[model samples]
Every structure is written in C-alpha cells, then in structure tokens.
Target chain A: MTNVDTILKDMIIIPKGIFFRGSNASPDEQPIKQILLSAFAIDKTPITNKQFRAFVEQGGYDDPTFWQPKGWAYIRENEIKYPNYWYDNHFNQDDHPVTGVSWWEAMAYAKFAGKTLPTEAQWEYACKGTDDRKYPWGNKEPTLAYANFAYDCDPTELVRSSTSVYDHPKYKSFFGCLDMAGNLAEWCLDNASTNYKWDRDGKDPIYITKDEDYHMVRGGCGLHNEDFLRCTARDYYPVSVRDNLIGFRCVVNNVKEEEL
Target chain B: MDILDLPQVEESRRMVCVCNWSIRRTWKGVRLATIIEKAGVSNTNNYFLKQISVGTKEKGVYESTIPLEDALSRNALLVHSVDGAPLPMEQGYPLRLFDFGLYGYKNVKGLSILEVTDIYELGEWERRAGYDKDGIIRPKKYWMVDLKGWGFAEKPGEMTDF
Candidate 1:
C-alpha cells in the first residue's frame, strides 16, 4: 500500500469501513444497509473542462486502450468528439465541471488520469462520511453556500458556471472532498443495481452485475430540486446516454501502509 | 416536508407491475399513510385524495391522485425501495409514489413538492396527451385499455439530454 498523500496531491483519502448507505424515505432506497470498503483516494470534485481537455488533447477519442471494448466500438461508430454540450468543438469554460459526457467518456477519462470511477459503494461511503450527513454539509437545507441546484441558474449557463468546484466549502465531505453531494451527479463505476445487495459479512462489496444496461450516477446537479440535493439520492442512465446534467469524479485504490 | 422528520414507516408489497419501464419490480417503502400523516392529513379518512403532485424544478409537474381509502391501502405505497435497496435516480431515488391501481404516470419520480389538494385534475400526460385520467389496469380489462389510446406510453420530447 502506498501513502495516498505522498503519491497524489489533489485526491483525498476516504477511510475504509462500514458506512451508512441508502435512504429510509423512498422504497427503492429502502433496506438501509451498511457495507465495508477498503481505503481509497478520490478526487475532491467532479472533473472540470480544464481536466478533460488533457484527455482530448491526448487524442482520447482516437485511442483504443483507454476505453472499454464496447465503448471503443460505440464512440468510433458515432464519430463522436467533445461532450454533448460542446459547441464548435469547444467547452463553454475551462474551469466549469465537464458535463454532457457519457459514462463511457467519463470512464475513459478516468483511465487516462490513472484512476477509476468510484464504485457505488465507494461513492456512497465518501458522501456518508463518519456521521452519514444527509447532505455533505450535514442535514442543513441548501443555500447558495451549498450547491448549484433548484434551478437557481440557467441550465444552459451551467456549462459555463463561474462557480469553480472549490467554491462550495459547505458542500465538502468530512474527508475534505468538495462537491460530493452536488455539482453534476457523478458517474460511478458500477452498473445500475436496484437489488442493492448488502454484504455485511463481506469486505468492499461492489453491487453490479453483467446483465445491467444502466450505470449508477450519484450526487445531484444544478437544475435539480432540493429533494435531489441529498447525499443518499442515487441516479442512473444508459452508459452511452449523454446529458448536460451529469459529470464525474475519479477514485484510485491507493492505501497507505502506515494507515493500514 | 422534511423527509427525515416524517414519521418513517416501512411497508413492502408485491403488486407493482410497470408495463413500460420496470416489469414486476417489488417495491418497498415508507407508507403513504406515514407521508400523509407526516403532512398532518390523518383526518382525511372520508375525503378522497383529489390530486397528489410530484415534480422537479426543471420539469413542470407530474400529478395524480387516488381515492382516500385506496391511498391508505396496504398495497398502495409511497415507495423508496426497489428490490430491497435504495432507489436510483432514473427510478426516483429519495421517493417515488407507487399507486398500483393506477397506471405508471401516477407513480411519479423526482419528488420535490408533494401537494395533496382536493383537486381532481389529470396529470401532465393524462390531460395533454389524452390518457385516461382514471387509468385502471387488469390483464383482462380490455375495455379500459382503449380509453388510454396514446396513454402515458409516450415519452416526453422536451427531455433533451437529461
């Protein structure tokens, strides 16, 4: 195990263990269960246009190795370049969280960055933190200090948000990860699994199966209502489906020997 | 209403058979009784539920209602659990109303405001697209099916890249 702090400057360590997952209010969110996770390093925020540009400049679209087998076939078949929101082959701003990228695009970018999309369990573990606060800022209702949500900004204008990821201090998780609750609902590594198989006896359980078509996306986005702003709210779409409301953060299985 | 503050009640049922999106999904959740009780409407025993509206900030509204007695039934649910787990977004994470008697449109997703008013009105699709407001479903209920000509089967065109 390598020391996360020594190996990476921007990522934060989400300590491993049992974390509170799911919500009690919704039926699909029932069976509020706990699961164990191994320690890992996760990005402090969703990827920005500036970060994604490196992948694009590295010829991410043309490269085959960074992509999954089917992802390569799909993107190549469509001749896709840039995200869905990009116009004239350019993003609105360099610092804005990159939106309109499919799960495949986001996953490929994670590979290019030497990281992986956080698993659904890992993503939930990061948000739930030590105390399992409803929002990353705790049970408090969101204000401008919390998230870019509730249709507060124009959806069109969000791709060019002046709110750099670091702006929401209140939205930071207990581990010092910002935008874990809101920004753009991030893509996770797991395929959509409503069956939320709780592994109380197992360690670092990732709940996904091969037959799944939809992939999990957590955290809420700019145009969502306050109901979606909570940490427990889970979202998903077809891996190939691209939308302006979703972006993603990356995680790595980096554990420090000293901490271990 | 504060979701946490609401009187939490866990109820499971086997009746949900979503024809379009989900097929034979077992949904468990906090009871509509608990939700209405949380909304301080426990006194609505005799009065029928006229309109129960659930909506997102971006999308206008997805509204439907049930009779008071049916809304209070054990089978009907204000579901959050899909197959023994926390709901996912496209399936409505924090909450999704599961009215087994009515069609899927009444089982709204992305609940921001759940206004329970005595307003007997058709939801967005039921009125605009000519779906039967009183969508009753049974395997042999063929007569009711024709009333729902274009029914809630049509997906929204405005949903561009959500």
Candidate 2:
C-alpha cells in the first residue's frame, strides 16, 4: 500500500503511444486524429494555490530571470498581483486546485518547480490513457459522479475534497494518475492554433496572436458540463485572462546522459 | 417583434465592433430607446461602457462594451432571434445585442448585465494586451496559400519557395 506521501509524488509516468484527440460532439472538434507522444511525466494533480503562494513568496514576480521576455511583458502590462480568484475563499485549502492562474503564471510555476508544462500532444496522451478512451475513465459519458462539474454546489466545494483527492474512485486514470479529466482546466505548453500542422510541429512553437493569446486550455473544469469533459475537448481563453475554473499541471522530461 | 422579454437595462445601449462584416439580420426585440426610457441614463458623454456577459459558469463572465451612439442606434436591438430562428449556442441564444455597423465581436453573446458608466473602458482582451479594438475586417485571400500538391520538401529552401 502506498503511503500518502508516496501517492502525492510529483511526476506521473505516461507511456508513449498514439491516442485519439478532440471531441466529435461539435464541428470545431471534428477530425479527431491519432497522436503519438514520447513517454513523459506529468503532474499528478493541478497546481495548488499554496504552491503558487510559495512561488510568489519567493519573489517570482520580481525576478526577471524566472520568466520569458514575453511573459515578463505580459506580467507588467496586466499588473497581475495574484491569481484572479486567489482572493476568493477557495484558496484557503492547501489541496484545492489553484485558479486565476494565467498560462504565463502556470508556466512560471512549472519553471520554478524545475519542470515544464506538457505540450498539447503530451497532455492528450496522458488524458486519453493507454486504451484511447474518450475521457480519462473511458468512452462512457461523464456524470457528476465521475468529475466535479456544473457548479453542483458552491464554487468552493472542491476545496473540501483536497484531502480526499485520491479517495474519489473516479479520480484514477488507467495509468494511475489522479484527476486527468476534470477538476480544473489545465494549461499545455503548446501555443493555441487551429491548424493541425501547427500542433504537430514541435519546433518553433507558435504563440497565439496578442488578440487570441487566450491559448489552449485542456481537460475539463468544475464549471464544465458533461459535454465539455471529453478527453479530447479543447478550450482556450486569453493567456493573461484568469478565472476560478482554470488551473494547471506540470510535466518534467527525464533526460538520460546521452540525450543531454 | 416582442420587445418586453429582452432584458432592457440601460447598459444594453452600447455595442462593440469586432470584424468588419456587420451583416444586419432582422432583430425584432427591445430597442435601446425603450431600455433607456426605463433604466434612465445617468451619464451621456460616457458613450463607452462595459458589458459583462454572464455564462452558466460564474467565472464564465465575458465583458465588453461599445460607443454610446453605437449603443443607442435604432439598428442596435436586444436581438432575440437570428433569421427568425432562436439563437443557437454558437449564436448567443436567448438574448444577444446586435449592432448594424460594428464588427461581430461588438455583438456580445450570453449577455447577463449591462452597466452604464462614463469611463472609456477597454474590454477584457483590450485591457490586457491592447488587442485590436477597431473591429475592422481586412480582406485576405486565404490563411493557407495553397493546399493542392502541398507535400514534403526535401530541401528547406524549396519549402520556402513553395
């Protein structure tokens, strides 16, 4: 039996393979395709406000060295002091998923943690699991029991579940990761683009234009309906834009000596 | 053309223009004049106002606004129908504000509240990164120049030429 500390470990191993991505529910989500991913590690859960608070306490904002040039500019222009919803009472819980984090903030946290955000491909591979199901669980339609969604109760209800994040039977992935399908929307490293070719090309990642910087957010959130919880469903909002339903998970690439 | 059911608050008077294709579909709903008559505008010079659209999710609120004159125009209607069909989810059903001259983005979707204020406030995307506020649509041939015969190029220079 795994101890609580062992179960809460950072990196989750997702073996590489092609999996179907994108929902068939809408025209925009049409043309689902098989995506092949190299094996990688992803965070077991969404980043928490407590972790973000530690970053902020470390003067993440004041350190230019920690952020990319564009990220720094975005931080300055928005004058973002904290996650948009961090002021809300939900943040009091250490286990609650952090919201109000911009894509930039999420990236900063990943960097601070000595990790990187997973690419869209990596994210889809992890969420789809080895069997290539429609959601983390399987092809079955999502219900409230499978995920926290549709604002069934107060927005802060999920905070109470932090201590029990692993207890939920539906939280387990085929690969044994927790909460890949729902809880909060997770940010990916990919720049938001509609073109499949753009998504496939790993080098020279494209940044969404300033107007559409609301980059791609994957997985579903507590606010999402069953329809939005599809494993391949894609949603995006501006990078600087923050809200309570949005959060992120981190990924780390394990490099061997030869690769290094 | 029933106008009463549409939420006719004072802030509904304004609209924002996104792209230039401002096709006017028949919007038979409450007029800005009717809404203003009821809500009573406190500030006239503050043509620019912010419109916050609340979605089913509490955090799903999308905020935007338009010029006062744009908001007050006769063509501007609290549109309940598009082409006589109830608006679909893609079309901002139930109630949407449509302005004849403004681009599509100015026509906010899933509207919930309209606040009338004097501040020339930038909308969400605008305030964050100074995104294009003009809403002017420039003609372009195509995002992808040519799809036909597009294939792998052996040389990088050949790909560039293509």
Candidate 3:
C-alpha cells in the first residue's frame, strides 16, 4: 500500500534562512526583506488530481513544443480545456489538489516530471522552515480545523481529507513537510515583480520587469487568509492565468538523477 | 443616505484594471444612481454589485461587481468620503463603490450587501481562482513588455485595437 506516488518520490532538502519576506498587512507588503535562501528541493504534496491526470494523458495538453511562448500564447488564447477542478466530478479523488494549473502549466508539469519549479528562494526556503514560520505551521492563527480554511466544511464538501495523508500529527513539518499550510496554492519560479530589499545590500533583488506577464504564486489556499497563508505570502497571476485555487508541486534537483 | 454619511471619491475615476492606473480624485457619495434608484431596479434586471467586509463569510467573498448599467450609472458613487477624509481602511473605509470605466478591482470594500442579480456573479478573485475574468486592459502594446533590459517600440501608424 505504498502509493502517495511511491511515498513522494525523493528530494526535500531546503536548508536555507533569513526569512521575513512581506505583508505586515500590506503597504504592498512593504519593505520587509532579508531573504538569503540557497539550498532547494521541494514538492511533498500538491500536484495531485491523480498526478495531473498523468500529464493530461501523456500529451501534456497537445504539446506546443512543451510550452513557453507566453505558455503557448496562454494555451492558444484560453481554450485551456482542463484542470481547474477538472470539470468537477470530484476529479477522480485520490486526495485532490491539482486545480487549473498554468504557471506555464506548472512548468509543463515540472518538465514532464523530470522536475523543476521551486525558486522564490526555493519556495521561501521550503515554507519558512528552520524556524522562520509565518506558517508551514507556526506563528499561529489559521483555524477552520487548523488548515483547509474558509469555514472548513458545509460548503457542500467538494474535496476534504487532511487528517491522514501521512499521519497528521498536526500535519507535520519542521522539515518533514505535509500539506504545507492548508492544501493548494503552490507554484513558484519567481517573477511577481521579484522584489528583494531584505536590507538592500548587493545581491538579492530580482523583481523581473520587462513586459511582465506574471509568475510568483506561493502557499496560501484552503481558501486563503491568515494574511494569505503567510510564509511571506505573495500572490500573482498572468503566467497565462488559470485558477480554482491554483495547484503545483515538483522540484527534484536530483536524487540519483534518472534524467531530470 | 446614511451608510455613515457616504461621500468620498477620486482615485481618478478609479480604474485600476489590475494596474493600468487612473486618477482623478475629489469625491464623496450617495450616487450609485442613488442606490439603484433606491433599490427599485427592474427593467428586466441585469445587476452585479458585491462589496463585503463587515465580517465576510466566504464562498469567494472579497467582493466587487457592477454592470446593471454600471450600477445605474449617474456616475455611480456609494463613496464615504476620501480626500475630505473619512474612508481609509487602506482606502475602502465604511463605504465604497465609485465607478467610471470601473476597474481597481471593481471599487469594492466594506459595504456589506448589495446582490441585485439577474445571473452572472463570480467575483472574489473570480470564483476563488482563475483571475483576469476580462479585467482586460490591452493597451500596453499587448504585453510582453520586455523582461529585463527594457526597450520601447510600436508607433508606426499604431492602431492595435484599443
């Protein structure tokens, strides 16, 4: 019975620090900086919907050369076709989380699962672990049964499960990672105006600005709010936008690199 | 006429269609065509007005909508005073809604309920995901504005469809 995709296939490293990213309740998440992050490797959950329906049944959405010409002009100008609650028939269950993709379809399903998408400092150093916690399980105040937010139920239950996706000892993570704050709202490769300023020294300011088409989305969903699931909560769209609480997860820097 | 003495407007006719920016301030309200002609709108109805935050309950509830003829346009304005100082919980205060080519997230904020309906509602970040529900701006030369070393162009008889 070892299938949470073979118990989350490899790489979770993430060792890095200097947290305090943004949103002291917004002055556009004013000036809060101090980034630093270096070590990477994420993806413990999120990217489900039965592994993106096996990357859209192996064609990865009619392969426009594996996308990125503004994500094939936003999937040929929004004919998008699937993945936002996938026409909602409970989308083949198995622990949900895989909504209307599109950070270039989660970087083409992390380059067809070889792996690659974390980098907003490796997803805020794996959601502020090493004790920087604004969340990922710290700095309190999430409620709605401690995760899966927005009043947690009675919205006629669309997709629920958060008590045992791996023995929820309060959904672990001091680097054991499990449902990193709620469930859904991942996707990061940096480009939501790449701001740095964590003290304006020399290296750290990226905030990409040419022809900006939007990129950065980070943890914060279960309907979102505790200041957008904080771990420096920042959100963005336009990587050919798609939604339904957004979804993503895949970052194999290499664990016996089978070819990623 | 007393949503706390409404009357505040001017982020320049308020169009922020996700940052295309607009500005013309000097407002103070009660106009949203006088609250839909005092809530009597019924010309085969086609309304859309959401502006929550008095203890939001959820189901995509941040709120923002318009187009019942731009909320009965007579220069729509449920405002609660801005420049003359009264509306400021980060600029949405006790009242909000001041349209004119609407955008700035449909100028919604802290005004409780206004669901007049005819069928077309999905506000709050567009049904909790999948934004840009036609918050279309399309003038920045069809976006692609250069990624780093910035450059500029487009003027050779320019007419890229506004």
Candidate 4:
C-alpha cells in the first residue's frame, strides 16, 4: 500500500454508542453526563513524525486550501514553514508522535489528510468507552509501564521525553487506540471553556468559540503528573502557542443515514 | 561550595511553566546575588550565566542561560527546599534555580554546573527543542495547580502576583 493508504488504514473504527463524557475529577469535568456520537475512524496512534513529514514536504504549509483563514494568516505572519520541532532530531523520529504543533496547525493537517480532529465528546467517549474508567487503560494509577509520564518525584529516573507512538501497548484505550493516555496530548476540535455548558444528554457536543480562543488538548504527556492523565482530565492552550507537549490525531466520521 | 551552608531566606512565589501551568509555593534558598557576590563576581552585567543539569542522555543534558543581571537579581534563588521540606529528587533535590521572572525551563532543575561567560548562550531547549531564548513568563491563561483554578496573567515578565 502507498504511505497515505497505510496511514489511512491504521485508523481504528469506533462504533456509534452512548458513553459517559465527564466525571467528578475536576470542576471542569464535573456533572458526569452521557453523550451520543456517530461512528468515527480515529488514527490508532497520534500522527507520527514520518506521517507529518509527508505533509510538510508535500507543501502542506504552502497550501492555503488545507488551512483555515486564521491559521493561514497566522502562519504567513510568523512565517511558520514547518512544525515547531520539525528539524529537532530529538523529537523527529519516524515512529514518534509529532509534537510542537498548535491547534491551528493540527487542524490544517487533518484537513490535508482528508479528515478532521475528533470532537471533545468523540475523543473522551473513545477514551473512557462504556466503562467510564478513570484512565484509558482502566483505574490503575499510571506508571512508566502504562504511560510515558514523568514519575512523581522518582529520583533515579532523569529524562522525560516522548517515546515512540506505540511504545507502551498497555496504554491502549478501550477502543484499542494506542498512546491515548500519554505521549503527547492530542488536540480536539472544540474550543476550550472553563467548564462544560452542554446539557446532560447531547449528541456530538462541541463547544466552539472564537477562532482565536484557547482549544482543548486531551490526554496527557511525558511531562505531566498522573492527575492530568485521567481519561476525564481536560487541559488547553491558546490556539497559537505551539509548545512541545501537544500533538494531534485525525478522525473521519462514518455518518450513518439516521444522523443525516 | 555546598549550597546548604549559605544563609537562606524563604519566599512564596509562583513557579510558572511555559506549558501553561503554575503553582505558588514557599521556596527556601540563598539569593543568587549572595552566591555571586561570595564568588567575587562583582561585574555582573558583563556576563551571562549558564545553568546545567544532570538530565538523561536521550533527551540531552538540560541547560538554560540568563543575563548576569537577572541571575544576580534579588528574586533569583538557588533553591534546595520547598514548603519547609528539602527538595525531592525530581524537584532538583541538591540545588535548583528559582527565577519566577522566567519559565520553568530557565529555572533549571537537577542543577550541577553554573558557568559564567561573557557571551550569551542558547539553552539546551532553545538550541534543540525550539524554545525562546529568554523564556520570560509571558501573559497567558495558566492552570493554577495549587489553586485548583485558572488565572490569566495580564503582564509579561516577572510574575509576582501570588
């Protein structure tokens, strides 16, 4: 298969279902609610360095059609020709998740790849599944074996860096997605709000605000403590701040006739 | 010089990370100015300070640089304790710099080497990881971990609002 075909084939199909979206973990994730979502195909792992390298080399940054107007303008203004860590040898491994991408860049990539970022509801549903597990891999606390987290005050371990996308198979989510609990937090489609404003039952709920506002990043990364790694945990960054702690995955919705 | 032997002062300050997290805690350490003065480095403005740490090989050794003036500022501290407790190993047990004016990267942890040089040097993160050279705490929305809430810093440089 071609590289694009292989990348497309690696997506995991999450069937349509009803799942609890939030938890009592934090005020932002308060008032646990059930959300219904259509079937969607999500990248099994985050977009890898190799996968995104194609986007960069294929003139992804140069193409305006693949980018939002704001994103296009921002890139042109700052002259952002590539991912922030594109040339950094430490983070640019073939199989490692690409980091240092802002939500706008991630959106551009998803558009370029013929997909879109998963909505916050979709992302959280796929993570917790029907079980409402505290973590993607279930309720057990995070360790180096389960996720690539910076161990809490562990003296012996020194460096904290993102490993290969699938370094820890045990970190898989309920839908058999890898690295959903850690590596690099994945950007979602929705803009971030201080707390959930959706009703208790909603379908494919997404809280989009002004394009320039902060956007949500789900899961956690190597630098975060266990609290941020919980399935219901929520964090966000301004749409333009491209730090190394965030990356993204693409999703293609399998819209059923009933939904249409 | 043993950092513990130096005279110390305790101050509560907000430690901000470039990654959008902040925490306010009491840190006890000797002021950087005191250490620099004791080392007989009187002409502080003529040089830069490089803070090096014993980080892992895979990620490269962690290093950060600051202007000599900022390094010798009253807020710059070589901290060894937090909240009445000695620093944990992960928190840079032996000695670490606490400069609230800059991001967490500039307050280098696991600190092992302190080099004073005439020329400005880019830090490890700045050289290899695409971080800003100065890493000043910029105005942004930050998750206040200790407060269990969110805060917006309206001003850039030297976050003193606890």
Candidate 5:
C-alpha cells in the first residue's frame, strides 16, 4: 500500500553486535576495529534499473520531498534527468543493476523508497558477518558464479541472472544479501578517510558525513581486473562524481518482529 | 613540453587503487607542481593551488583538484615512466598522475586539461562512481582481489587491465 510496504521485500536483517570493521593488511585498513551496530534492514541486492525506473517515473527527480537540501541543489546544478546510462540508450532493460548515479542520487532513491544507504560498518557486518570468514558465500575464493568480476563486457548488466538478484542462495550474505562482493560497488553513507581508526565509535556509527572529502563505496564490480572483490576492500569517489562501475543498495532501521 | 624533460624524481610506493587493491610500481616523472610551474603559473603555493583543478579526457569521470600541498610533494607526479620503461599501454601511458593522498583513481590517467580554476570537480571515476576526492581508503576490505595475499596475488603479477 505504501512505499515502505512494497520496497521492503527481500530486505535482510543484520543483528546488533560488535562486527569486524577494518582489515590489517594495508595502512588505511590497518588497526582492525570493532563496531557495535543495532539491527537494520538492508536490501538483498543493489537497486535495479527496473526499481529505479519506478522512482523516476514517479517524479523522483522533480519531487523535493525525496531529496535533501544539498542533493536537490546537486541535481539542479547537474540537471541530471535520469541515470547517466539511461540516456545513452543502452541497457534499457529492467534487469541491469543501475549504475552512474552519484551518492546523492542513491540517497534520494533511498529516501523516495523510505530507506537509507547502509554505512560501511553495517555493510561489512552484513557481508562478512561477525568473524573473518573472508566473503559472503564463505571462505572460498570468487568465481564467475559467486559474484560478477573480471568481465570485459559493458558496465551495467543483470546481477548475473534473474534468479540471482535476490534468490541465489550462494550469493547471499550471512544475513541473506546478494552481490556483496562483486556486481557493483554499493555506496555506503560514510566519508572516505585515511584516519578511519579515530572515526570508529559505537551506536549507529556514520563517519565523515559532513566536511568530508569522499563518500564511501563498498563491494566490487566487473571493472578493473582487481582484487577489489574482496569483502574488505572499501573504495571511494567524490560526491559529485559518477561512474559506470558505481551503484548502491538501500537499508532501513530494523523494526520489531511484530511490526513486519 | 615533454614530461621527460622536466626535473624527474623516482617515486616508489605500494600504490592502491580505490578498489583497495595494491600495486608496487616505481615511477619517474616531474612533480605536478613543477609541471604547473613550467606552464608559467606563478604563486604555486599549496594554499593558492588548493582550488586548482585537473581535467582528463575520460568522460563521466570529470575534473579533479589537487590541494597544491599534496602536489608540491615530490611524491605526486605527472609520471611518464614506470619500472625503467615507458608507461604501459594498459596503464595510462604518455602522462598519468600520482596522488600521494588519494587512491589510484585520484591518480588520474589519460590526462588532458590542467588548469587552476575554482570549480570543484571530480575525476571521471570519482564523478561517475562515488570515489573519494581526498583519495583516502574506506575502512571495509570487500576488495575484488587481494594484493597483500589472501591466497591471492601478492605481487604485481596479480594486476590486470580489466
């Protein structure tokens, strides 16, 4: 009946706990920290072209109710009519994961749909769970089937297959999320920081939200024959920037069992 | 002017792209500030150049800026050489940038326009995707491959052109 009721399907619930936040293999990832997050509901897959199309068709771009103050200004300045790839007249189908939307666009989509982008902390907790299991499916390495990477095709494509969008048991995270490792880098609601160690604090930890350099993008994509597919490899881009490799999923504060 | 003709410094570091992947490449080139200086721009101090912008031919991923403080460091360069050879074709050849503070995306490739402007712009990668303008790595390690070894390639042998 409402946006919350319809859009919340296939949303996975991440429980409250102290999950691993960063890795020790590199400088930025160094000083592995523990984050305590309350329960939340995250979309099983990154927002799809078909889903986002509904938002645009519903006047999402024109509606001030769906946008924040700065986001509205950004959309106005860029005159962003729709997803960048949409105008290219490519991947017009409904199945492809939407790419080329900036962080503001992603946030607006979330707000329009009554959801929010998960922070990088919540993203890691959902993907890898409490321990260091290595990936969403398990400790195993990724192949073509597990998540989409190392491919030479165009940027936007289906999330492997129609069934894999929210049903593929293998691609699901411990909290039942799909495409956590590859497919597309999902934007998190955190700023990119070299000193992430100091930013770690408990209770719905969202870091570098204001006066920040870059917003955070999690997960990996088919672009770059990279080790970026690892669950811990966080990436970033400026707020105004857009890319073919970028897309995002949405999350919500977990309601009580009776509320659902 | 040819980048090779400018004063060159050997820049070596375990470079990591935005994807949280690492590559150890030794590059030689002129400091980005030096390149700006050779272009006849006066007052190349970091403060004045903080608003400096860079434009690349790559689309969607548009303009970028260097806090001239970072640009002045011999660490950042408009590199033409990597590992005693011309910059590889797979890599951004001819002239590519190195941002000591930002990720490899911040180290923009296929550079086209270099100017001092007030417009706050993002790289084509930064613009198209949500990459950090500051080039700091995010805390999550959900990387595609592991350059530091997760039974993954521990060296440049793991790098690819995709």
Candidate 6:
C-alpha cells in the first residue's frame, strides 16, 4: 500500500461554512453568490514533484482503475506515460509543484492518493474563507512577496518558472492552504461553464456534465498576471491538453460531523 | 526582408488558442504569400515552412511548422499591428504570424526565421508539451476575452462569427 502519511500529513481540515463565490471583476466572475460547502481537508500545498513521483513509480499511469473511462482511453491513445514536463529540467525539481499534468492525469493522481479534486465551491471557500477577500491573502494587490506571478518576480533571483511549493511562506489562505494564489493553477472537479448562472445555491453545490468537456482551473500560475491570481478568477482547459502552467491539490471530505 | 516594405492587408480575424480561449482583432500586416514571393523562394516541392520566434526566457523559442499550401493561403499573415495600434510587446511586437485557420500556437510570435523544409517538424509546444502537431482550430466553447464571456465556435477552421 502507498504510505498514507505522505499524502495525509499536512492536510488542513476546513470547517463547514458559507463563502461568497464569483466577483464583478470579470463577466465570468459576475453576480457574486454565496455557496455553502461542507467541511473538507485540503492539502496544505499543491502536490509536489516529490509527492507525485510516488504515484508515477507505483504505476499510477499504467493502472486503468484509477482513471475515468474517457481519461483511460485518452492516455492509451496518446501513449501518455507521465506528466508532459516529467523530464524537463526547468520544472522537474523534487519540491516544485508538479505541472504539465492534464485534468485527467490529476484525477488519476487524486484517485491514487485516495482523495478527490476539490469542487470549485470547496476550493473557493478554502481560499476566500468566511470573508470575501479579493485574493487568497487579503484585499491588497499581489506583489512577488504575496505570490509568484508574471511581471512581478525579479528575473535575477528567479527564472520565469514555478518555484518550490515551499517557497511562498506568506501566501497562505484563510484555511492555512499555501500556494493557493499562484504557483500553478489547481484543477477543480467541476466541468467548465461560462458563469454561475445556474442554480448552485444551498449546500455542496458542484457542477458536472454528462459530456467529457473542458474542466475548470483555479488560482493562477507563475505565468499569468495579477488579474488572474484573484480568488474568484477562473479558466478552463480541455481534459487532454497538458499545460505546464497548470497543477492541482487534492481534498478529502470529512465523513464524521463530530470531526467538524 | 523588411516585412513592412511588402504589400499589407488590414483585416480583422479571430485567433483561437489551443487552451480554448479566443479573441478577434483587426490586424495589419503583410501576407505570408506576399513575403514569400518577395523573398524569391520556390515551393515547388510543396515544402513545409518552419517559423521560429524570438521567444522569452520563460517560454524559450516558440516555433511552428505549416504546410506550404496553408502558408500561402490568403489568411496566413505576418501581423505587425492589432486593433489600430502597434502590436504590443507581449503580443509579439514587431512581427508575428497569424495562421487564422490554425490554433494560436501555429501563429508564432516575435518571428525570427522562416525556413523551408520537406519534413514535418513538430513545433516547440508540440515537442515540449504533447500538443497536436497540426494545431487546427477545433469546434469548442472558447472563453472570448474580447467579449468578456464564453462564445461557442459552432464550426471549425477560422472562427468568423463576428
């Protein structure tokens, strides 16, 4: 069995609460609405190259049981053996957040860890908390000190690449989730929708589709500007396209009400 | 060759990124066919055109390879201006190729070299990441940055639903 300690050690238990979703910043983020989310434990930081190495070494990619049917077919058809940037020296450091992973690969990794990708509501709540904050940290705009983003970092000290997941000590969210603002945008469980125009009120609202369409990605990446780094900012990518700027964190829903 | 010295076409076109976002803007530049003809290059072998870009430190050198027929199409343009202004440095400054029928990756930014070859060379993103070498614009729901919302491209190829 894969050691549970590595995946569960730093999990932060977020209390059940209501947090506002969406923002007026962009049309996609319009008509801010309150979303209720159940208590869930989230990884303290994004899954790192070191953490994912275990999954790869354990033949996570070769196992079909861990992946959805469509995802499995895609991996087989594309002959995907590992993350897209698996061998790239620039992004292959042990502690850097693992990127170049498609949404399906992320889903497989989550399954391998016995966890699930966070629903968009859970992810937003984890970052925004009870208060409606513009960013993960607070209302203030992002500087390099807050998050790793484009046009912000000094080129001398850092190359234009993802830093170690442990680098941003100050960019923690309300629920103590680190690297939630920028590093690599995290994948959420929901399928891509233009806006929150549907009925997502009340508790544990998650959007899924019968079709294997594009999936949502949240937080921002090292390559995007501050506008995309906001907590409410959203984007999507095809399930099979492995991008270097996208990574993910996993979460486990609390089973016991008393545990909350 | 100075691209600005060649014949230019001022037209508006849509550029769809493989990431599923797209934008439409008025572009001003010389056609790839015009530039090729002015350079006195022969494509009798139906060779592919390899485009290289002066890419940034973050992205390295961006590259794209297009079939000779597509390169000579009326829509294949080496864009220098967008939306009535000089192309922003981030948008590839002086010159960038906009192959309207293909995904944005095919439109190499900050173009530096144009080589003719018979072999099908994979572009930078296709080589580094696992992008499709063809880079065609597929019918999909694109997050239209210009429209500030999602827009569906009902048909494939160049998105002309203005």
Best TM-score among the predictions, by candidate number: 6
Per residue, candidate 1 scores C-alpha lDDT tens digits across A73-183 of 867876777776665233347766788788889989988888888987788778767697888778888776687764322245523342567778655776778876656
- Arrange candidates by DockQ, descending: 5, 6, 4, 3, 2, 1
Per-model DockQ: 0.03, 0.06, 0.08, 0.09, 0.26, 0.22
* Cα lDDT of model 2 by residue, A39-66, tens digit: 6667777777777788888988877777
Of candidate 2 chain B, the 10-residue stretch with the lowest lDDT total is B136-145
lDDT of 1 by residue, B17-72 (tens): 22212234556666677777766886665555544335567766666655566656
What digit string (tens of lDDT, one per residue) describes model 2 on residues B1-162? Answer: 345565543322212222101122334566765666567775556466556776767546677777766556534577666556676776677777665444456556877777776676666655533343533222211111123221222221101222
Winning model by DockQ: 5
* Rank list by lDDT: 6, 4, 5, 1, 2, 3
Error of 4 at B157 (Å): 13
Off by over 4 Å in 6: A1-7, A152-159, A200-202, B1-7, B11-96, B100-103, B109-127, B131-162
lDDT of 4 by residue, A27-85 (tens): 67857777888888888899999999889999999999999999999789778888887
Clashing pairs in 6: none
Off by over 4 Å in 4: A1-8, A153-159, A199-201, A256-260, B1-11, B18-23, B26-162
Backbone clash count, each prediction separately: 15, 9, 24, 0, 37, 0
Q: Give the TM-score of candidate 5.
A: 0.71
Please, what are the lDDT tens digits per residue for candidate 6 over residues B1-162?
677777879997888877556788999998878877776876535788888898789878887898877657635888999999999987888788888889888778888888877878878877666566777776555667777666666565888885
lDDT of 3 by residue, B48-148 (tens): 66555564455334765556664454366777776687878766778777554444565567767776666565566654455654343322211111221
Q: Residue A76 of model 3: what lDDT?
A: 69
Compute the lDDT of residue B159 as modeled in candidate 5: 32
Which docking class does model 3 fall in? incorrect
Instruction: Enumerate residue pairs that collide in model 4.
Output: none
TM per candidate: 0.58, 0.63, 0.32, 0.68, 0.71, 0.74
